[model samples]
Target: MNRPPLDRCTDGLPLPPGDDLDSVGPFVIRCVYALPRDGTDRRLGEDGTISRSLSAMQAWFAAQTGARLRFADEPVRTVRLPETDARIADRGSYVRDRIERLSRRQGFHEPRTLYAVWYDGSSTISCGGGAWPPELRGRVAALYLQGAYDDVVCAEDRFSPDGVAPEINEFKMLHEILHTMGFVPPGAPHHTRAGHVGDNHNDLMYAGDPPWNPSVIDPYHQDYFRTGRTDIPDLARSSFLDPLPAGAEPPPVW
Candidate 1:
């Protein structure tokens, strides 16, 4: 894969992680900025919005679970789509799938690597999408940045006791990453047909109403993150966590 100079990326993306495939650990999240040939490069990944949101996400995760996710070595990177804006932007339901496949072709698909693409392109689809573990073969998820185009940074004051504050972008990106990681297993008490917690609208994994008000990750602590049971899968045991064991296990096949 061709990479721009270490100091900056192509089309002015944030400084990208080095292209050292031999060194990146398994089960890590790779952040990417994606747009089509004719699409404008907003460079949100560098302009502080994405960086701040990631900080908030890190804070939220560390606050909730006592560990942060293992992001790709470089905080963020960029990918220029092969197609023109018209062809890529209007993919609708196929957008995530299309982008994931395309990213794989660009060499983003390392074993156990989950993609978190911030697509700066329009789509008829919803704000974001993630791969539900049970049905996942592709290990990628994406946020349609054009939807709402929200840049809400974490409301620090309101986020301490409960993780309510996050840029809607980080919030949704985390949600998609969780989904791709096979969260809210079918055996979870509140598992829904939509692969979310059916019981709490405030829970991050809940499939709730408009004006999404997610505040926590499995408030019950019995579903996905740190479920005290061994019968069902647990994210606490996932290799995606920072400080995770070296040569960590790959994500389980659901």
Candidate 2:
């Protein structure tokens, strides 16, 4: 969808271009999901539910970090790490190791603390918003209701019986992950009286009242990362994490 022209947020900012994982510090992330044993009865929709949801989540995450998305269809070999680190324990050591490797491969830095937790059933879950400490702010990532779309669909549009379609689930995943990354989209705040503008539905930041298709990427996101601004007021801040040390560079991109 087309987006209105944006003012540049990075003006006069000295941060370097591209994502450097080392600079952002170590992240503690967790991945949790509700899946059927057979994996056959998985919700099916435009993107076949599971794959689309995962892709959308990954896309949102990449946009947040100003990085690109890459996935391995085949099994990934994980390294064994010492269990003494508290950050590593929040997420399994195996998962942490995998994330580190993936971050390095993608030329991104792992957050100081990250968690990807998957959940099943309708449990009202929330991550500490911007109120989270700076040390922990960009360090967490999570995935919930992997196979089920009910919660996400219902949240977007309660009246529709097709509460949680695969596409909707994917969009919700993207939306929440963007939240974790610290980009609060327009229409997110209930009290805000701002009129809807730009690509509201396509963007994770925009409210999904009518429920736009998940496959479409919001141009505002590109504008935010590219020029680092959107018409939305709150997004004007340099919410992205600090830059890498002098002469430090991220590992080669995958």
Candidate closest to the true structure, highest lDDT: 1
How does model 1 fare in lDDT?
0.65
**lDDT by residue (tens digit), candidate 1, 128-186:** 67766555445777776664323432222121222335755566778778877777688
* Inter-residue clash pairs, candidate 1: none
The ten-residue window of minimal lDDT in model 2 covers 127-136
Tell me each candidate's TM-score. 0.78, 0.38
What TM-score quantifies how close candidate 2 is to the native fold? Answer: 0.38
Error of 2 at 138 (Å): 7.7
Q: Name the top TM-score candidate.
A: 1
lDDT of model number 2 = 0.32
What is residue 27's positional error in candidate 1, in angstroms?
2.3
User: Where is model 1 poorest over a 10-residue stretch in terms of lDDT?
Assistant: 1-10
